[model samples]
Target: MMESIVDSMLAQETPAPAGNPIESAEELSSIAFGFMASKALFAGLHVDLFTLLADGPKTAEELAKAAGIPLNRIVTLTTALASVGVVSISDRKLIQNSSAAQNFLAKQSKYDFGDYLRYQIDQQMYPFLLQLNAVMKGDLSDDAIASYQHWMADEEQASVYSESQHAGSLGPGRTLARKVDLAKASTLLDVGGGTGAMTISLCNEYPDLHATIIDFPNVAEIGWRFVSEAGLVDRVRYIPGNAVQAQWPGRQDAILMSYLMSGVPGEAVADLLRKAFDALAPGGKLMVHDFMVEEDRRGPALAALWQLQHMAFTPDAHSLSVGWLTEAGRKIGFAVDDVDNLIPAMTKLVVFAKPS
Candidate 1:
């Protein structure tokens, strides 16, 4: 009887929902005030609160003394940190709540990513988001908001940006190396490969794979240092110039363009794709890993937010859709192979291949 009932239910076709369900006013408000939580986390990271608590629990007074901040401010900050679950307050002392805080937040940890949050997200992108309204309205002049080229021209800013991105990219880079098959490929072209994080990760994974990283001179210099530090200087080389304009070093079996498309104008993407296609040997693979929106572009809230953030700085920055990319690849004589979300609902990897 149970088997029959289950079969009957399975035989019935259910209609799909019409559209996204409307969010509650309170939920909408929470989304709007999300910056408060971000700011709190940033503040905690900025003061190295997690690192201070790494030894053990500490009283607000002790934290204030160690961090050289006022006791009152530390108290308030600890309370906010507690609310965010990064720290816990027990017996009037604060303790690091999770291993994430200990591993990623602490300065002493080998996998520390605190600098990424501090420099890229907090110092750079946070301020850029504030200008979204002006940017959308076209009130902000091009010179007023610095493009990636302009920003990277400043060596100090480029170093900070590159280092921060390199730190943040490590985990994702390892994941990419594991997920993608590079065993058959001999040469890879890592376009706009900042600090050689991804290249280093890939080379570490594949013993026979050699990679050439192409980026601006300032970023390329930093990448060379990182590659050298990783002892991958022999396999991974840096080419200092624009990925789109500069002469591609040689024909590659695989090419990776990560987090580069969203920083450029939409019209320029096709040209870049064409360039990648032309630079690849027959049957070569091209991997584009970046944030992508759904066909409808309604809300995968993170991607939408990132798109808005990019718009604030870049003149034509917008989240590309997978369908568009597949179509674009088809037009460029490449076969679209797969589109998979590397970071569930956030970053996507769209893979294409040149026909042999």
Candidate 2:
């Protein structure tokens, strides 16, 4: 009797909903207008809209004058921004940072991710989302190659993201800069360090620690410019070369691989860790910091997706497991400890040490 009842239900055929086509149309319309959101956000950044709104709400004329956008465009930009609730409009007048923007978009928050958003948008990750079809067809899109070569050149030079290391800056590198222990080590080698920001931060923190910034010649030039301007030239030395092929020239009490090693092949990551292990003094510590993944390779959807993209564009791109890294460091005879959630929503840090 139960089998017969189940069969009856299984054999039933339902008609498609009458509103399926309308729902499909609305979805397509939403997809089509998504870029409007991109422009609104970027234009907001371009015009210092967030900065202007920082103080208080302003009339459209005041906002336009402050942001330098034309008066005619102000209404449309405001409407677009407000539609997303970048501002609140009561009495048809403007106010700043409606709840969502106040928390995330404002320049003052620890969560100031707006710069990164605009950077990715202008850097073509946002624009390139539309060209996934082309990318699937092997187009080798600009965003792919651009950031790759940008890093590839650094990898070529053994440079680190040093300049990208300011404590107050807006990313994992900076986050790592502020928290990672820079003391107890007098000589630090920042391999593939970009901008020398990390070195600068460490120099300030440890006072005794001096660092070398190595990367591709051109990128190192930029790092040099920054460090010079930053008045850190005496403490941080910039070296131009490739990390993979060139022998990183220096011995140290400790070595930092901050936010480096992403997209490096599994074997190469092992090799690099081994190299750093050998370079460390008998009791030196090696800090391996990057966007860490869950041990099961789940959760933190964006970082996991990024692990794949890191592989997709670069020649030897891939992510390392923190567990695997700790195990490998142990195999090389380093005492290892895992520090989870160091960078807040971006990375977990792994620490490996060689006893003297």
lDDT of each: 0.82, 0.64
Off by over 4 Å in 2: 1-39, 65-73, 83-85, 98-117, 124-147, 150-179
- Residue 103, model 1: Cα distance from true site in angstroms: 3.1
- Considering every candidate listed, which one attains the maximal TM-score? 1
Shift in Å, residue 119, candidate 2:
3.7
Model 2 C-alpha lDDT per residue in residues 1-356, reported as the tens digit of each score: 01222223235553122223336777897768877886888888767777678778888889888877898898888888888767777785865767556655667754555655555434434543544455556776666554544644544322233222332232444445555665678898887776676666567667788888666676677678777886777888877776555576556887888656885666778788888888887777788777666676654554565565555544355566677778777887889754655543345678777878
**Deviation of model 1 at 114, angstroms:** 0.8
- Compared with the true structure, what per-residue lDDT tens digits does model 1 show for residues 89-188? 8864655546667766888876677888888899998999878888888999867988888899999999889989987787777777877898999999
Which predicted model would earn the best lDDT? 1
